[model samples]
Target: MHAIKIRLSQEELEQLENLAGAGYSLEQIAMYLDVPKNDFIAEFYDLDSFVNYHYKRGLLMVDAAAGLALAANAAGGNITAHQQLEKIRMAQFVEREKKRIIYGQETP
Candidate 1:
């Protein structure tokens, strides 16, 4: 048996993107769109892919704003801002190291 195909209109897609960016879960977005959660999942690639795309987009926006604030604070000699930036840099370095180790790359 062939699976039923569900097509989203352009407006619906835009709405989905907006809702997802607002941190709505897949189930919530599905309900807002008036589509069954299961059907929406089946129609789309998967919940993770759809949710992650929008969530990451939202995070990027937030990160940009935070970065601007941090820059201003650092320029004004805010020690806490400097510390927070260092912590974030260290965490990013650790994550990169982890990825390298997982991929069997020799670490210097």
Candidate 2:
């Protein structure tokens, strides 16, 4: 079986970038684009990277706003924000520990 070639219009590209920025999975984006997920994956070269570029671009704006909010909350002594930040840090530490154990390294 031969692979199908899909050409996206400028509007479609914009829609794709929007959907990806909204944290839609590849499968979800494929569905929105009315294409089979496997076919979309087969046709697109470096699909994840392409989507991630758009996603990160969108996140840049959000990150800036979030940073401002975080700073404001920190300044106001918001315990909830501090706790949430600590929770995120602990989660990251746990993930790193899991990776280290999986790679046969000692977890400090």
TM-score each candidate: 0.56, 0.50
Q: Tens digit of lDDT per residue, candidate 1, span 1-108?
A: 235455567677667777766777878888998988887766555434543454456556666678779978988999999888878778878977997889876655
* Highest lDDT against the true fold, candidate: 1
Candidate 2 residues lying further than 4 Å off, grouped into runs, are 1-17, 21-23, 41-68, 103-108
lDDT of each: 0.70, 0.66
Over 37-77, each residue of candidate 2 has an lDDT whose tens digit, in order, gives 77666555454544445545655556556756875786689
| RMSD of each candidate relative to the true structure | 5.2, 5.8
TM-score, cand. 2 vs. native: 0.50
Candidate 2 clash pair list: none
